[model samples]
Target: MNGYRFYTAASLLLLTALFTACQKSAPAPQEESGVNAETEIIPEPNAGSEKPQLTVAISVDIAPYVMKNATTGIEVDIATQALPGYQLNFIQLPYEKLQSAVAQDQADMALGVQKFKDVEGIFYSENFIDFVNAAITKKSANLKIEKVADLADHKVLTWQDAYLELGPEFEKLFAPDSPQRKNYVEVADQSEQVQQFWDAKDVVIVIDRSIFNAISQAKGHKLSEVDYASIFPEATYFKANFEEADVRDAFNAGLKKLCSSGEYAKLLKKYNIELPNTICDSKAHP
Candidate 1:
C-alpha cells in the first residue's frame, strides 16, 4: 500500500512538471502579418503664403497712359488708382525700348505697345486708346506727301525707334535702288526730329498726333498736319506685359472701368490732351 501511494504521488508530480514545461515552451501570438500599429502623426508647416510681392512697369512716352506731370504728379496717381494692390513702378524709356524692357523682364509691363509677332512672349492688355501717326512740319514746308508713295522724293524725318513701324512702308515705296530712299533720316526723339526739320526747309517730321498735340501745346509750337489715313488706317494702342497673365488682366479691367465711367476722358483733359475722334473699346484682341 505504501509503494502504491508513493507511485501515485510521483505520477502527480510528473504531470505538474509536464504542464509547466508546455506552458513555458508555447510561442507568443504575433500581430496580424503586414499590419502596422496605430501611431500619431504631426503635419509639416505650409510655405506657399510667403511669396514675394510683384511690381508693374509702365513706359513714360505716352502721357496720361503713363507720364509725369510737371506740377501735379497725377499721372502716376491715376495709374496707381487704376491698379490697387500691386506696386506700380514707372521706367521712362523711349517708345521703341518699351517692348525690349518687357521681354527682358526689366520692367513688369509697358503702358502701350504696337502689336508685333516678334514680341510674342509678352502678353497685351485691352486696347486703351487709338493712335494716329501723322507728319508734323513747319506750316511752311508745304510738302504734298499725302500718301506713303508720295514721300519718295522728299526728305523725311521720323523718331528713331519709330522707324521699325514706318521703315517697311518707306522702303517699299522707295526701293533701295530708288534715288528717293536717300532722303530718309531717322533721329532719336520726336523733339530731335522736329529740330532737324526746323533747321532745314526740306525736312518733314513724322510723329503720332497725340504726341504732336501735347508737345505743340506745351511748347507753344505750331504744327502743320498732313493726312495720315494712308499710313495708319486703324491703329490701336495696347498695354504690354513683362510678367504674368493675371496681372495684365487686372490692369486691363481697371482701364475698361475707367473708360466706361468717363474718368479716362477727364484725366486726359486734365493733362491737356485733346480727345481724338476715335474712341477706345475695352476689348482685348487675341
Candidate 2:
C-alpha cells in the first residue's frame, strides 16, 4: 500500500513538471498595447544622431540663384546637395549687412562675396560661381557705357555696396567725394531699382545678366526690350566666413564630385545659367 501511494505521487509530480514546461515555452497572450505575436518592434532612431546644421548668409535676392519662391534657386540646391551630412540653413540679409553678419557670427558663411579689401577674421573659399554684371539702360535712352568712367555723369542705380563690392577701381570711382557719388544711387531694394529704371529714363541699373533675365521674364519684358551696353568680365565669387573652414573644404570636395558627375552642368542648364568652362585662376579673392 506504501509503494502504490509513492508511485502515484511520483506520476503526478512528473505530469505537473511537463505541463509547466509546455506553458513556459508557449507564446504569451497579446495585450491591449497592440503588440501581436507577429509584430516587429523596430528601434527608434535618436534625434541627436542627425547631421549637424550649417548656414549660408545671402545678401541679394538673385532669382534663379537665390529667390523667395518655393522652388528656390540653383545655388540653394547646390549647397544642399553638395554637403551630404549637413543640414543647410539660409539667412537673408541686405547686401550692406552681409559682411557684417558674417563678421559678427550672425551666420556661418556669406555667399557671393568677392575679395577686395584686406579683411581680418574672414576666410574665403575657392571660387564656386561667376557673375557677369551688366550695365543696363533702356534702348530709347541711348545711354553709352563704353567704359566705367561713363557711369560718372549718369543717374546710376546700383545694388547697395556696389562701390565696395565691384572692385578697388569701382570703389575709387564711386567714392563719397567722387563726382560719381553725386549721381550714383545705392539702392537697397533691387526690385525698386529695376522699377525706377523703367519709370525714369535717366536711371541706369547695373545687374547680373542671369538675374536680369529672370526678372525680365517675370515682368513680361522681352530681352529685346532692354540693352546691355557694357557687361563686366566674369567675376568669380567665394563663400566667406571666419570659423567654417572645414565646411568650406567639404563643400569643395562635394563640388568637385558634382562637376565630375555631370550634375553641376545639368543644374546650370536647368536654370538657364551660362556654364563657366574655366575655374577662377586665382584663389586669392577676386
Best by TM-score: 2
lDDT of 1 by residue, 182-229 (tens): 777776556555556667876666766666666555566554443333
TM-score, candidate 1, is 0.65
lDDT of 2 by residue, 220-260 (tens): 77788778865455563645453567877887787777878
Candidate 2's displacement at residue 273, Å, is: 1.7
TM-score of candidate 2 versus the correct structure, residues matched by position: 0.79
List ranges where model 1 is wrong by over 4 Å: 1-57, 60-78, 118-121, 161-163, 166-171, 174-180, 223-231, 234-236, 275-279, 282-286
In order, candidate lDDTs are 0.60, 0.74
Top candidate when judged by lDDT against the true structure: 2
Using all chains and alpha carbons, the TM-scores for the candidates as numbered come to 0.65, 0.79
